[model samples]
Target chain A: MKPTSLLLPLLLACCPTEACEGLVIERAWIREAPPGARVMAGYAELRNDGASTLVVDAVESSGYFDHVMIHETLLEEGRARMVPRDTLEIPPGATLSLAPGGLHLMLMQPVSDLALGAEVPLTLRCGEAVTETRFPVSAAAP
Target chain B: MASTDRSALILLVLVAVLAFALGIHFARRTAPEAGAPVEGMLWPDPPRLESFTLDGADGKPLTEATLRGKWSLLFFGFTHCPDVCPTTLATLRETVKLLEETPDFAQQGQVVLVSVDPARDTPEALAGYVGHFDRNFLAATAPPDRLAALTGQLGILHTRVPLGSGEEYSVDHTASILLIGPGLERLAIFSAPHAAPELAAKIGQIIQFLQDSP
Candidate 1:
C-alpha cells in the first residue's frame, strides 16, 4: 500500500469528529493541601470553541484520586452550602470559570501526597469525547 | 420710624445667630456615617448574646464570658469542608494581618471558628484545621441542641447532607462572619465575597465606634 493511503486512514481515524477539537483548559490549578490532608479543591477556566455546548459529566485523575466530584458553593440567605453537581455545561464560545468560593472540583482520598508545583494529569469526559489536561498544584494566597 | 426699623433689624440678627448656633450643636450630636467595610447591616442597639457553654479547642469552657474584654469574629464551618470554609478562613487570616498593622487591633481582636459538624470535628481535629490557617485562631464545637441555642439567636443556619455511602457527609452552613463586641453583644455580620483589607478597615471602624459610644 502507498504511504499516502496509509496516512489518510490514520488521520481519518484520529479526527473522527469535532466534539473534542475546540475544548481548551486554561489556568488549571489545584489548591495545595498540607501533608496528611485527604481532600483538596481544583479551579480552572474551561473554554469551549465548538458550535455546540460542551457538557462535562465526569472527571478522573487515575494515579492521584479515585473520586472526583463537581460542587458549587452557594450563599443563600447568608448561609453557605456546598451542593453537588451532576454535570457542568460550557456553552459554545463561552468560558466556564471554576474559582475560589464558587464552582470547583472536590478531589478526595488522595493516594499519595501532592506537592506544590507538581502537575497532575486530569481526564474530563463529555459524552463520547474525552479530553486530557494537567492541573498544577499551587499554594493559596495569604 | 428709625427706632422701629433698628429694633426690627436687631431682632432679625439675633434670630440668625441663634439658628447658626443650633445648627452647629445638631451637627456635633448627629451620629457619623457607619462606613463599615463589609456592607453589613448595623444594629442601632446591638443585642446582648445569650449565655451558652461550648467546648473550646483547648478543652476549656467557652461561653459568653469568653467574648468579654475582646472583639471576636465568629464563623461556622466544619473541618471536612474543602472549599468555602478554608477559603473564608484564609481570607480572615489575611484580614487579621491587615488588622495587626493598626494599633491595638492585634491585642484586642480574635478569630474563632465554630464547627457545625461536632461529630467529626473533635477539639483536636478543629484545632489542627484552624491552626493550619493561623496559629492564634481558635475553634469550638457544641452539642446539637446547645449549638442551636447560639445559632438560632444569631440567625445562623446549617444542614447536613449524606454523600450516599458510609458515614461521609457534608454540612451546609452560614458563611457570614459575626462580629461580637467586647461586651458580648452581637454587633454586625460580614457576608460572603469578603475582601481582607475591607474587612480589616471595617473592624477598625467598628472598634472606634464602640470605644466612642457612651
Candidate 2:
C-alpha cells in the first residue's frame, strides 16, 4: 500500500528506515570548528510524528566522536553557561529546534578533522526505539 | 547602442541619484537626539575605565589605553567554549563586514575577545582560537586577579565550573558585548542574542551621534 502525500511530506525528512517511525529529524548539521578545536556543536530540528511522546535519552556518533551529549547554552545573570541534559522529551506533534545559543549537541573529541560538507552519522537512543541520521558539517545552519 | 540600452542607462542614473539622496536623509534622521539612547543601553555619562594590563596575542601588553583612538567591541569568553563563544565571534566578524559596506565609514570597529579562562587559554592559544574566526581580531588574557580588576570595572563576572574529577572545567562568563568609545569610556552594552546586521547598524548610528555631538 502507498503512503498518503500528507504522511510522505513528514517522512521525507527522516531516515528512510522503519526505526525512524516516531521522530523526524531535519536540518541536522554540525558547525565546522577551527583546526585543532577539541569541541564542536551540532544543531537540528526534531519533530515527534507519533501519537505518543518521544524521549531522547542518549546520542552517539560511531567512530566520529569520543563522546556526544545534549547540552544547552544558557544566559544567566549576564553570563553564558553550558548545562547538560539527561533526557529530552518531545510531546506528540511537537517540534524541538536545536540552535546555536540554545539547545545543541556537544560534539567532543572528534576522531579526525571534520571538513566542510563531510557527513557524520549520529544515532539517538529513545526507550525501545532508536533512529539514525547523518549530520553534515557546515559553517552555519544548513 | 540600442535605444532601450540608452533608456536603461538613464533610468539607472536616476535611481542611483535618488538612492544617494535618500541615504543621506535617512542617515541624518536615524541619528538620535541629544542624550538619547543610540542602540542598546546607552550610558548618559559613560565611565572612563581604569588602567589594567593583560597579555595580548602580539606579545605586547594590552591596556585600557590600547583601546583608545577607535571604537572597541569587547567579548568575554573562553577558548574551550564549544557553542556561544564561536557563535558570537562569527557574528562579530559579520558585524565588521556589514559596517565596511557603508560609504564614508572609513574606520570599522575593532573586535577584542577577552578570555576569562586564563588557566587554559594562553596568549598563543588565544591567537589560534581568535585568528580562526578573524585574523584582525585581538585576543587577550591575564591572571585571575589582574583580569578581575579589568572585568570588575566593566561589571563582567566569571566563575569556573568543574567537570567531574578531571582537570576539565568550564568558565561561565558574561555574554554581553561591551562597546567602548574612542575616549576609553563605556559607550553601550549590547546584550544577546545578537544579529550582525542590527549590531553594525547600531554601532554606525552611535558613531554618527557621537561625532555630531558638540
Candidate 3:
C-alpha cells in the first residue's frame, strides 16, 4: 500500500532486466556460405559497459539454423585448429572481438537459404539475461 | 748485375701470384654456387606422397597422377569451417591470380581443398564449396582411413570435436597449406596467417629458383 513499494514494483516491471543493457554488439555478420553448405560462421564485437564481467554462454538462431556454438581458432606449432568454447567472458568496460581466424560462431545445418546482404536474427544467452541482435549475411572475408 | 736480375725475378713472381689470386677470385664470384638453395623451407630431398585415392569435385579419381604435371597448393579443411578455411581459400585465390599474371606461370599450378569431414562433405557439396571461391578450385575428400595414409605422410593433423547432443560435430584441422611440386613431391609447407601477395611472391621465387636450377 506504500507509494515507494508501488514505485519499485512498477520500475521493476518496466525494466524486467538490465543485465543486457550494458552489452553492445557491433558489426555483426554471418559469412555467406556456398549453396548446399551446411555450416557458416558469424563474427562480431561484444562490448561490455557494466562494472562486472559478462559471460556469453550460448547463441541461438532458430528456424534459420539448427544451432550456433562459439568456437575459437588456436594456432599452435604452425597449425590452426578450431576449438568449441562453452563460455566467452568479456571483462567490464572492455570489448571482445569475434573476428575471422579468432573467436567466431559456428552456425550449423542451415534450414533455409542464406543470401548476402540479408539480416538474420540471433539470440545471445548469459545466465538469466538474454540479448537479441540481428547479423547481416555478408560475403566471406579475404 | 746478378743482384739486379734477382730483384726483377722476385717482382715477376709477385706479379704472377697476384694475377693468379685475382683470376681465382673472379672465377668464384662469377660461377653460380652449387646448391644455391631456394628461399622457402625447401626440403633438401622433397618427400613423395604415398599412393592414395580420393574423389575430386568432378567425380574423377584424385590420385598422385592427378597432381602430376603441375604444381598444386593443397589445404586440408572442412567446408563447414568459416574463418580459417574461407579466409585461406580466398588468400589462395588471390595468390593464384597473382601467379597467373606471371608469364609461363599461368595454368602451371592448381589449388586443391581436401575435406577432412567426409561424412558431411560429399563430392557435390565440396564442388559447391570450392567453386564458390574460384571456379577452377578443386575439392576432394576420402574416407578416414584413406585420408590417414595421405595426411600421415604429410604430417597434417586433424581432430573431430563433438558439438554436444545429436550427430553434429566440428573438425579441427591443420591450417598450413602444402605445396606439391610438379613431380608429385611435397615441396614446402606454408604456415597459416598467410598473406596473399607475400605467399604469391614466395611461391614465384621458389618456382623460379627451381626452374633456373640444374
Candidate 4:
C-alpha cells in the first residue's frame, strides 16, 4: 500500500496498545536473512490512527530470539556501517520501510533453530500500546 | 692510482645496477593503481598463516599441498553473492588473463577461490560458481566451523542480519582477495576497488621474483 488517505483509523480502533489507545499497527514481517546465521531483521508499517504523532523506539520477539533493536545500514567510502535509529515516528498516516540494505530491526541471539516456513512472534511497543504480529520466515524465492 | 680509481668507478656502477635491479623487482611486485603504480601502497611483511586441510568441491581433501610451488590467487566468498562476489571474481579472471599474456604466468602459479559460506556452497556449487569465471581456478569449502575459522584467521567478516518477515535476514561481509605463495603462506592482501591490469602486473612481478629467488 502507498499509505495515503483513510477511513482506516475507524477500523484500527478495534486493536490499540493499552498505553496509547489511538495508534494501530497495520502489518509487520521478517524480510529474509542469509541462511545459517542466527540473526534476522524485521520491518513494520505502523499507522497512528490517533490525532497525535506516535514514536516507536523498541521492538521484541519471543518465538526464539529476544534481543531486538532498531538500526540502519549506511555505505560510505566503500564501507558499510550499521547504526541505531533512536525512534520510529508515525506522523498520523505515514508508513515506514525497514527493507533490505537499509533501515531495519535486528533480531539477535537465536534461542533455537528458526527454520523456513515458520512464524516468529513480534511485539512493537511505542508508548504503552503493544501491537503483536506473526512474522513468517520466508524461503529464498525460487 | 689509475687502477684503483677505475676499480672504484666500476664497483659504484655495479652497486648502482644491483640496487636498480632490486628496486625493479620489488616495484613490479606492487599493483599498479589508477594512473599510478599500485606499489604506491604495499603492506609490509604480509602475514603467512599456518596451513589447514579442507575439502574441495569434489569432496576431496585439499590442503597446503594443492597450493605448492605456484603463485596462487586466493579469494573468499560465496556463490549467492551475485553482486560483489561475481564482480570481484570476474576482475580476478581478467587479472589472470593479463598475467597469462606475459607468456609464463602459468609457470608461476594458479588462481583459486575458497567459499566462505560452506553450507550452501557445496563443492559442486563452488565448481559451478568458479567455473563461471575460470575453470582452472580451484574452489573449496568444508564445514561451517572450518569456514568461520579460516575467515577469522584471514580477517574476513560474515555476520547475519535481521530482515522483517520475522526470521528472514542477510549477511554483511568483507570482500577482499588474498595472495598465497608457493609455500602456501599468505604473501599479500588486496582490498576493494581491485584493478585488473595492476593486479596482473603485480602478481606477474611477484611470480618472477619468486622464480629468481633461491
Candidates ranked, most accurate by lDDT first? 2, 3, 1, 4
Residue A9 error for model 1, in Å?
20
The DockQ value obtained for model 4 is: 0.04
Instruction: Report the number of the highest-TM-score candidate.
Output: 2
Clashing pairs in 2: none
Provide backbone clash counts, one per model.
0, 0, 0, 29
The CAPRI class of candidate 4 is incorrect
Model 3 regions more than 4 Å off:
A1-19, A140-142, B1-40
Expressed as tens digits, the lDDT of each residue in A1-142 for candidate 2 is: 5668667667656655346457999999998887777788999999999998889998998999988888888988667888888887899999999999999998878999888899999998886467999999998888
Candidate 4 scores an iRMS of 7.4
| Residue B154 in model 3: lDDT | 90
| Candidate 1: tens digits of C-alpha lDDT, residues B102-134 | 665688888999998888878777777788788
What is each model's TM-score for chain A?
0.83, 0.85, 0.84, 0.73
Better of 1 and 4 by lDDT: 1
Worst 10 residues of 1 chain A by lDDT: A12-21
Cα shift from native, residue A141, model 4 (Å): 26
DockQ of 3: 0.51
**Candidate with better lDDT, 2 vs 4:** 2
Q: What TM-score would you give candidate 1 relative to the actual structure?
A: 0.80
What DockQ does each candidate score versus the true complex, computed on alpha carbons?
A: 0.49, 0.49, 0.51, 0.04
Q: What is the lDDT of residue B48 in candidate 3?
A: 87
